[model samples]
Target: MYKISICVISFVFLFFLSVSLFTFSMNFLLNELTYFIEWEVVTLNSSSIVMTFLFDWISLMFMSFVLLISSLVIYYSKEYMAEDYNINRFIMLVLMFIMSMMLLIISPNLISILLGWDGLGLVSYCLVIYFQNVKSYNAGMLTALSNRIGDVALLLAIAWMLNYGGWNFIFYLELMKNDFDMMVIGALVMLAAMTKSAQIPFSSWLPAAMAAPTPVSALVHSSTLVTAGVYLLIRFNCLLENTWLGQFLLLFSGLTMFMAGLGANYEFDLKKIIALSTLSQLGLMMSILSMGFYKLAFFHLLTHALFKALLFMCAGAIIHNMKNSQDIRNMGNLVLQMPLTASCLNLANLALCGMPFLAGFYSKDLILEIVSLSYLNMFSFFLYFFSTGLTVCYSLRLVYYLMTGDFNSSSFMPLNDEGFVMLKGMMGLVIMAIIGGSILSWLIFPVPDMICLPSELKLLTLFVCLLGGISGYLISNVSLMFENKALNYYSMSNFIGTMWFLPIISTLGVINYPLKSGMMILKSFDQGWSEYFGGQMLYNSLKMNSSYNQLFQNNNLKIYLMSFIFWLIILTSLLII
Candidate 1:
């Protein structure tokens, strides 16, 4: 046991070290790879293929977040899963997930990209059901099934692209210039991304996935599985450039952001509240990315990873101290007991709410600026604005619920802080959440000219941050005054909570209603046809034919052989004809 523990520890440290090195050397790696410039060597069947260096500014930005979040989540979970029965299996799955995500980030072809995508989905199922509970099992199954539907769509799109575009490889740089069936392929890819990212109509699986441990939720939701879709879409931004499909993606993303934010506000379970908020933030990120602001989207993805993981880990620490109860209403005055955890939580929440000077402020405000700059249509701008408001509301509610309520002494377990390993992981992410945006802007973009935000836009961003935080505070305070009974009157909120059923019912109605009516008409036609054909007589002949039964009896071998020969001859004649 001791040896196994040491080996696992050593492996984790090595993996994290490699990731950090990779992130720092990303530009050099891309430059070196690009210098070689051999696109002809790699071929699919007889088709010539172009393989470009994928470690571009955008890919490197996402890779940094992926490595940072994934490493921290793994580190935190080492202590988080200390007492679990299947610790080795858990660690194995985590490593595989990280490796697959790395491969996904650097993939140069569509087939290779799908390989990583599917691998992440596969391991996600294992992590989700690691607890081996009925709920976890069911949630994992649903998530897998939903993701498989998206995978099928993706595969179909790949086939369609190959057939129409005559491009056997799905290299973004090559496919960018191709015009044939780009719309169809783009729409299918969007559908695939929507499901993977847990956008509306497919978002329930994520909330259900809260059955997993906090670290798994933090890793999968914050950095890996959900982000894959955004990464895919952004990696192929040229395909989405100036298209109606792009507009559709932007609108859908806006709708998901608003709906998910509302859901997060209504939720009380600690992990789930955070889960839904992550979904909302991802939705906002998708909206930004879909609008052709790849840099802004990458920035938001970076900030969101740091803060969301920190938030989940902090919530996990709280849950650990509270004897595994995740109900925030049952939590209060925790700031007084768990100062370190509370401080981290507050920092993360501040970033999430887009308070000025925090990482989220820089990234999210950039997205808001892009939305304001959008001259495409009024509907897109209004949707983005409304969604941004809800984002503020829910983020504020999360902090208020955990920290400000009256103390519930009954819910408090002995004040036990998380292990040093876990705290170390959370603290690292907290620091990143504070400084990531500035560092990224300095490292990746061209000096002063590449800084996308104008001075006026920068000031507008600060103003929006201030306005959002103040409004969120006011709403949180007012919300405390309402009794739990007041919630019952909010019919719209109830409908939204049960909104998963809406799509299911609509689908069944579309499929079943017409089929039922058609079946009734078909039954009538069948009855009429049977009457015309002496159906009763035929039925009676089959039912009471002693000769027919005798013909099939074991004692009547010659008769059976003759009947088989006649049928074979008829089938052969039909085939020949």
Candidate 2:
């Protein structure tokens, strides 16, 4: 036992050290390689297949964001899983996950991208089921199965591109530059991305994934698995431009955002609420990306990683201290007990709610600005507005419920702060949530001529934040509306929280009609053939032999003779014919 414990500890330490080293190496290479390479392309086959390594603005920015978030999640997980008996297994899976994400981000070919993409899905299944409980096992199965469907779509898209466009394994530029059927490939890829990103119908798997531990949730939500779909869409942006598929994606993203935001507001479980919020935020990011604001989407992804990871880590701390109770109603006045955690939580909450000068303000405000300028129709505008309001409501509700409520006896415990390793991990994320925007704006985007915002829009956003915070607090503390509701009405909230199912039902309806008709036609043909040719039952009886059955039952010598004779007669008949 002692030896096993030592091995686990050493393995975990080495795993994290390796991730850090890889991150450092990537950063160094980014600097040195930029000086040597301007543009280079190498053809791999006669079919116009090629690979290009050009460090463009968009790719570099996304690559840096993914690497940074991945490293931080690793740091958080090291401490978050410190006490688990299977710490070594967890660390191994996390390292593998990071490797896959890194490969996907920097991959220059669709083949390499698919390799990393499928790798992420596989590792995520293992991580989700690390506990080996029945619930975790079921959740893992569901997530894996749903992701496989998406993978099939993506593979089909790739095959379509290679066959029709005569392009294979090349960079996205070459794929887009080809004069192929963009609409067909775009629709297929968009469908694949929607499922992977948990948009609308596919969003069910994300909340189910809350059966995993909080650290896993943070990694999946903020940095690794869920972002794969967004990456795919961004990579194929040119193909998607000026297509009906792009419009459908925009509409689907808007609906997902609205539903997920409402669900987040109604849920009381800390992790579930965060999971739903992650879905909503991902939807908002996708919506902006579809609008040609790729930079804005990338910025939101970065800020969200910082704040969402901080919030999840803090929630983990709270849950750990409370002996694993995840119910928000059971928690109150925790700020008095764990000041360090409360402070970090508050900072993250403020950032998520888009408080002025915070990281979320810069990213989310950019998205809103883009929406305003995009000339969307009324339906799109209404959906975006409602989702924004719900985002504010749920983010503030989490803040108030976790940090400041009436002191509940059930929520109190004789607990000390978590270790330095945990706090340090969370503090790094908190700092990013504070200053990430300024760094990205000044160094990355370098848009000094463009003003940050109009004074009117800035005031409106700030006012919305203040109003949401105040309203959420009042509803939680002063109002009797929720308390007085009947059991049936309370169940209605649960139904609303599961609204991701609506899209699933719609998708099923769309698929089932043709499927059912095809099955009926096949059945009719089978029946007609049976009536005309004595059916499968009669055919089976004609081939049956009493001797053969006896041989199977008793291993008798007579059976072998009969079998040989039957084969000889059949061979003779064939020769005569």
Candidate 3:
């Protein structure tokens, strides 16, 4: 009830904001409007810190979408978390997360955004560990620690901005676009965004965070948390255009997309597969931003949120009915038992694959077309096309296993869409996923993005779709036994299947050796030679000194006389010398 009321308030607020902005855009053309509420200023140093908010098409539209999705997710949670004892606490944490995201969306200042940045990290850690299990605990730790990297990076960026004489770094982006100091700031911000966005070395945490509740997963993976990095880059896009670090982002983001898409095809866990898909989409966003298409990247970001949240909700329904079993191998012919869920799932999957007329098709197809027109080198070309194809391939593969096979669950298990609250939550998103892309495409871009290419190049997307579909069908239904066996083999399968051992590398490879070395050092130095020389050696010397002092104090005349004679002999020898 509290959730529903809060969501309503948020939805109405964003609704009026959208309407007002749309009306304003019709009368006058404003590039940007910034408002600052002064918080403090140091008189002696002439420095000031203020709460600055930037309202533009990007922030308003993005905020509307965030609020819409969050509202739906909260409504969906009513039934999903009905049995939990701490439902109020859960709702509070979620609302706090939404507030953080709101702060992030509005603010343009480096120091101000940190408030939202740290808020996201801390709240997400709480959400990940909501279950209080070992897996959840571990996932929470990884999520918090990985995001800590971004926090530290942001702090460094704030420090770097001090040299520019102010904390409102957003104001300086254009003035210092090509300067060395701005370049350094851009690099640090990019690094921070990558950690928050889970790029490369930080990629393992996003998947691990699936240990969280499904609603949290839907929100975090879809909009609020993971997109922080992409949004950060979008804000800094002006500074990054044509820079060497932009080229590096293009290369690595492409790799991340490819890696995640490949990893998705090999994953069997239902939520994990979706999480990896989210990673792939993030890579796509980052890569496009690197290529200087900030608007296009943001367009895709909004549309992806709609469909991806629906996809996760539908998945949540299936998981709830399936007795919490998330393995796709254990699920089959679910469409017959749960028709509405299957329909929603199919729609979401189609949108993900860029099916014509769906939400993903408008933004995704345009992105690919634009990428095609760009003057990319051979490697970049391969990465772009292949990653796009991989999206279709894994999506088709998922549908085949879950929708086509015979029912594999126990006879006593009844699967049905009894979770109406969940389905109700999905309804609005379903409509959006079907038409949101087309509508946003019409509303957002004043002029259609230009794509000049050969006929063959223009049809590349269709060709890849055909190839990926065929490949997916063959692998899912008619692949050779030997091929399947090879995939299950220990060495070959493990490398590709476990995401090139990134999980192991991020965890064991990172910590194991360093921890072992520390233990060895503690034993060899702190406990061995240092202890013997500092503690035991000092104690023995102190005892010997005390014993010699007692001997000198002995009340024996013979001892005293012997000592005196020794001193006299020493004096005679010195005199002779």
| Candidate number with greatest lDDT | 3
Residue-level lDDT for 566 in candidate 3 = 99
- Residue 238 displacement in candidate 2 (angstroms): 2.1
Q: Which clashing pairs does model 3 show?
A: none
TM-score of each: 0.80, 0.78, 0.89
Query: Tens digit of lDDT per residue, candidate 1, span 296-361?
Result: 777687778878888889988788778788887888777777788999999998888777678887
Candidate 1 C-alpha error for residue 65, in Å: 3.2
Q: Assess candidate 3 and give its TM-score to the true structure.
A: 0.89
Tens-place lDDT per residue, model 3, 298-338, is: 99999999999999999999999998999998898998999
**Each model's C-alpha lDDT?**
0.74, 0.73, 0.87
Q: Which stretches of candidate 1 lie over 4 Å from their true place?
A: 2-26, 29-53, 164-178, 409-412, 449-488, 498-577
Instruction: Report the CA-based lDDT of candidate 3 relative to the real structure.
Output: 0.87
Residue 159 C-alpha lDDT in model 1? 86
lDDT for model 1 comes to: 0.74
Worst 10 residues of 3 by lDDT: 25-34
- Give the TM-score comparing model 1 with the true structure, all chains together: 0.80
Which residue runs of candidate 2 sit more than 4 Å off their true CA positions?
1-57, 164-180, 409-412, 449-458, 478-480, 500-577
lDDT of 2 by residue, 1-577 (tens): 5424543464456445645544544555445443113233444555344443434444555555655555555566666676787776776787788778767776655666778889999999998898889989978987887788888987887787675544333334544544555566667778888988999778878887888888778778886789888877877776655556668888999999988988887788889998888888999988888876666777788788778888888888888887888888878788888899989988887788777788888888767766766668879877776687777888878877777867554533765575566687688778788998776655445554344556776456556666666766666665347654678756767677667355355446557989998888777777666544767767676668665575577866787788789999999999999
